[model samples]
Target chain A: MKKITVGFLALLFLMTLGGCKKKEKVKVIPPAEKQVAKTGEEVKEKPIPKPVVQEESIEDMSLEEINKKGYLQRIHFDFDKYNIREDQKPILIKNAEWLKAHPTVKILIEGHCDERGTEEYNLALGEKRAKAVRDFLISLGISPDRIKIVSYGKSRPLDPRHNEEAWAKNRRAEFVIIAK
Target chain B: MRKILIFMFLSLFSFSQQEITIRIKGGIPAIRIAVPPFIVRATTQQAISAAKEIEEAFRADLAFSRVFDPLSRDLIALVKDRNPEKPDLKAWESVGASVVFIGKVEEKGEYLRFVGKLYDARSKNFILGKSFYGKIKYRRLMAHRMGDELLKYFGQVPIFTTKIAFISDRDGNRELYIMDYDGMNQMRLTYTKGMEMLPAWSHNGEMIAYTSFRKGNPDLYIRHIYQGRDELVARGGSNITPDFSPDDKFLLYSSSLPGNYEIYIYNLRTKQRRRLTFSYGSDLTPKWSPDEEKILFSSDRSGSPQLYIMDSDGKNPRRITFQGSYNASPDWAPDGDRIIYVSRVLGRFNLYMLFLSTSQVIKLTSGMAMNENPCFSPDGRHIVFSSNRSGKYQIYIMDYDGKNLRQLTSKGNNLMPSWQKINYRR
Candidate 1:
């Protein structure tokens, strides 16, 4: 009876140790998997799958819904500049691909500016921004006839705050689906 | 020193009899004048009120000229008689005034008659006198006419009869409005729900050409202001910043039709459009030279926006501004000797005047909130621009050399001021 009690105690101790080891393994493996998931998200953010996701979401959604879902991303410009930045190229490519997937769609490109310049000059600058986007899409095999450009200049602002961040956001080109 | 003082006194006395001739010999000092309360010939309250308003309008007009120093009301009250045909010249001269303007208003049924006379205080004789008859509502116009006659006697251009057309968002939408040069008689000229901007008055002051987004696109429009009729001059692409030719036979504008903003001129009679610029960059805000032979416009063809001058035929496009990376909204002076424009320096916009003959640029505004859309007054000696220095965008008028800055607007975002050429016949 004494030997059997000692054996039971030993068995209980071993079982507790095993449970702790399992908990340790769980804690260890999760961070590694989290790292992998983070890297995977970074990989997904590349040019390849972005348009596919955009296309899938855009097909079933209305124009307002698409806009609400942010399927078409607004592209930003530098101060007093209309040239698209290199980092924005991939996004434009994704937009172009999405536009291509929907053959019957028409888009209007609205160019905007921060309230830092004269209204008339900003109008010209905004037009240039819209044209830059349209030209890029055209180069990516999208039809020019499907796109129309308008310059709101500094009249419309995405963010009304008077600061650098707000100005950066205000100076952007936005796409609105006119027809589908 | 006594001898020198005596000699100066003698010289001054020699020219005292010919004050007008002496005033013209050197830089004319602002003439000191007295404008007392006008005499009301009618007994009714409304008639008396109308006379008071006429006097006030006349005083404001003279003050706006910046060439007259109107005596204080306190000084004018010391005069015993304020009659237009009476002996107040001695009282005015005692107050250091060299000229005196006296006026009387009479109510004649539906019309008011205003008679104003300018007197040389030293001569105690009438220098000039004029009478104006107009509807009761045109009392201000009558006063302006009187002021113009006074200005003519001083060899200064009369601007009180001019008008200013500007863009205002007071009605929850940007629209064009015309007001008297002193900001009285504000009238809504365009009811288009969309944005209307960049108003340019025709040379004859009969029409106003502006850019409107009424049809969901920026297009050029010309309206016969008095006739209440408008026509679309250009559409289909971004057409903006329209200016009438000196002869009022053509409209110069900028369009983005060829996938880029370029200057274009459209003939009013034939409706023929001619492209003036073919650069890859944007060219906009074209202003006709006084002679209508050259066009001064802002162009970004050289990688940064700068002022450029091209012939009326769109030939020989040459850059005129090189000091700033951003220079735009060029208005050629009516005298055809200078150009006024806005330039961006250290991220703040300010007005600069370029003397065409010398290619010299002078900064007219400094440390004031962003000043822009500068247009020369009809005389080319003053400029009207919009500034936010007062914490809100308002139209301001300053001398050509940036003196006597006066705010012309106080409500809403008043911008893009276009001074109308005076039509004396009107």
Candidate 2:
């Protein structure tokens, strides 16, 4: 039940945020009243349509709408492992939904490794972790085209201390907005 | 007068102190005592054994242990009236010798003969000496034999003439190449159009094992240079970084067979492949310890890349680097005390060395160009690595201290250098 709720929230959040985007509206108005004809004629008022708000429909809204808003998301793995657990799917799905809502937005998924193995192996391992998240997104009906993934490979850490909690946070995938 | 006396004392103090360096053989100190010449019957074919040349080599080779005590001897006097085949003990004892080395050298037109002997002053018996044969190029072998003689005299193993097989892009692309201890006369052993990279010379040096990315996927292959042929070793997956065991009977490599890169060990004799790492994170680049008891590799189990080491049986895996934000591709030193790796600092890559116990970090290379792959020479006195310092990627050699830089290749962009281990096989 929690997984389904988390997944629904992620889908909704992704739909609303849409990551990163930019837009601007320009307005030009004709002179309120043309100068009255100098030949002793009264000035005349021009009629103008009252400005009305019209919803601007957009097909690709995943990336742009989410740029202004930020998210704090985390995925956990078992000790000495990098696979995303079943408990973390709903959490990730929530973020994916927001991405789908705003197509213009782009996101970066950073994969990390714990401090268990050699540094090189950890780097490659981190890459695999990040790639795992990428594949999951595509599986969730999220287009792979909107996401960029990179592995820190055990270089970056959420906690510097050597302990279970620190490693748990270290073995995670993070999402960041790259463009709007 | 007082000032002069103080000055004399300081001068004597400075002169009394000496700075010396000696080589270690099998991590043990070998003494470097000079052995002079010995006189033998000039007409005999076996006149010279462990001759003067071998004596010098013995002294030098013993110094490798960093534990030799030099005793200067006069070759002319030792051999002037003595026959090395049988020598009087009294003459050598008169010199207050802890040990005495006596040898004879005979010259016959274009041919030569050598006989050598080592005597223990305490036992009054021959400790070492043997006859040998070889040409000028193999003269070093004669010295090495004397080294063996000295070691066996002290109950130690002798290591020389071992082969080192490493990946060199000196010719064009990264390919398997072999060379002597000093990186001299390197021969290109692989001639495939595709890259035969990360060549790890088998512990025996007779076969070179590496990852060939031919056929669009990485595969492990072992080649015996003399026969000009190779054998496939892995079952499937992009197998790379194949490091052989100390006995050359097994190999440790990285494979992505199960949809993610992981570590595996393949027994050469048994033809069985064993998976070593099962973490969800991909594990790659496994290096065997000097004793083949541990494996070192890189992983992203953390958020970023770091260096890690595990046991030969894939147990008790621990992280080795904490200071660096990025560290990978660690090559263990033959002496088993130091590990050289590539560390990324501020978006730039360079070579680094970490002392095992102290973890004292030493940056070996610093330049604008990327200095990624580093390999230690067989003697551990020098290292060769790939660098772009010359505006192009090329192989460069430098002293272990990062001095005396020399460009080994000037053409083509060469990279991914893997130094072959060649200190004991021969």
Candidate 3:
């Protein structure tokens, strides 16, 4: 497993280098004088340095361990509303950034609701909430295929109490790392 | 499906006619009746206990019917006659009971025989007589059958033998369970280890369709309960709130496969599905009209959830509810004139009934507790629903007018009850 990941990272690095080198060669050739300043062999053999991304080594972590890091924060919604609250947008944006960083990670977004709505309608509401969050993440450049959604309806509650504070906490979309 | 629905419609029409006549006759001051202890002719302890259980269960059924006002135990003890035959009619009439039930139980090896006789005390005439024979373990069933017979004799729909399917988390997870209408003989049906909700019973009472997350998604599953078989119906997205068509040939449910919740009908015979609603909002909990021509569902296309009706083939959709901003979980009555639904007002959910002909609404329950998933009994005289008034959700039953509220479950949290009528003839 470790060797496969290492080889995969190497292949990704080589692809990125090839992409950078092609753009430089094209631009230099268009400026005919610059192309002549460099020899044909020099231009062809030039290797572009890869940009470094500061990410902790998570390739060796299990799905459960990676999820325990809590990289993705759960977003909240208003009562009976699936639209992401303005205050919750930042949480989704951060979640999208983390997901973008972990390109190989796949996640499940569980939409939940409070005890205020009926069971069946709350189920649909939960799904709508999850979809709303999933759509926002996709708008932020997260692949839709990497984000799966399920609605727990009002079955799973974060706070078992029956007050406004508890309900506000219950109406949320939780993120779970299913694959890493 | 059309043929089956036509036959059912015919039978239901005749049944409703009987209901109207009986309601008019016995509307004021329900029929006063007497239920004395059964005379047991059994030698073994098992037979005697079985006889006692059957007698108690039968008495409970009659009292729960609300059609019969059972006499007090003191009034029944005034009579000395225990024999079903040759009873003193004068003594029963003197006790102010219009009708009297006399029963006898006999032990026949491993089987038990029950004989019940209903008689009119004023005219001293026999009204109905039934004899049921079954194994000793089916004492409650035998009692229910006798109660049904008495109900049938009174021109009322027989609901004593009907069963209620519900979801319970008593065994550590929400699973499907079923019990008698009187809350006896409770049995667990599913062991999915995942949450199961919204169980809808087929008209035949041999199958139940529900949504389960056993495979990590809310998929529709049909349980052929008697055959010990199961079939996966809908998947690929969150599928929930399954309602069996009146003909039991198709399932009306909602799926988010098209990126939003919409109603769909799945043909059980052909294994095909057809979308019913193309709303940009979520449409869930779709139920069929009694005649199977119209459909009732909840949708948020109007910016908030509300009840809507449309043709079964998904045409000419119209909004039926305009009073509430959030109304959902609508169930049509067997009479095709009344509908029961839950409406959220001020963050509290309550059950309400709508009269389609008059366009009038009546509040069935009032309190701060959440009352939801109200379903009519197959007889259309009573309703079964789940309420959290007791601190945790438990199943409750009440009359159509919302009287005589009784809690049916006490273990854990129970919700989403669907009551179905079983044809004993089958």
Report, in order, each candidate's fnat: 0.69, 0.50, 0.88
In terms of docking quality, model 2 is incorrect
- 2 or 3, greater by lDDT: 3
Error of 3 at A179 (Å): 0.9
lDDT of 1 by residue, A109-152 (tens): 99999988888889988988999999999999999999998998
A best-first ranking of the candidates according to their DockQ comes to 3, 1, 2
Model 2 misplacement above 4 A: A1-180, B1-30, B35-114, B119-126, B135-137, B151-157, B214-216, B235-237, B280-282, B290-293, B333-338, B346-426
Per-residue lDDT of candidate 1, residues B214-279 (tens digit): 876898889998899998899977998988887788999999888778899999999999998999
Which residue runs of candidate 1 sit more than 4 Å off their true CA positions? A1-70, B1-28, B74-83, B88-95, B423-426
lDDT of 3 by residue, B1-426 (tens): 111111212345564554233322323335788888888999999999999999999988877786788899999999987666778888999999999988999999999999998889999998888999999999899999999888887766689888999999999999999999888888999998988999999988899999999989999999999997889999988888888887788898899899888888999999999998998988988988887899999898989899989999999999999997899989988878889999988877899999887898999998999998999888777899999999999999998779789999999999999999432222
**Ordered list by TM-score, greatest first:** 3, 1, 2
Candidate 3 residues lying further than 4 Å off, grouped into runs, are: A1-56, B1-19, B23-29, B81-83, B422-426
User: Using TM-score as the measure, which candidate wins?
Assistant: 3
The DockQ value obtained for model 1 is 0.48
DockQ of each: 0.48, 0.19, 0.54
lDDT of 2 by residue, A94-160 (tens): 8778777766667778777775544345545665677788888899888888887655555467885
Q: For residues A72-118, what per-residue lDDT tens digits would candidate 3 score against the true structure? A: 99988888788889998988888888888889999999999999888
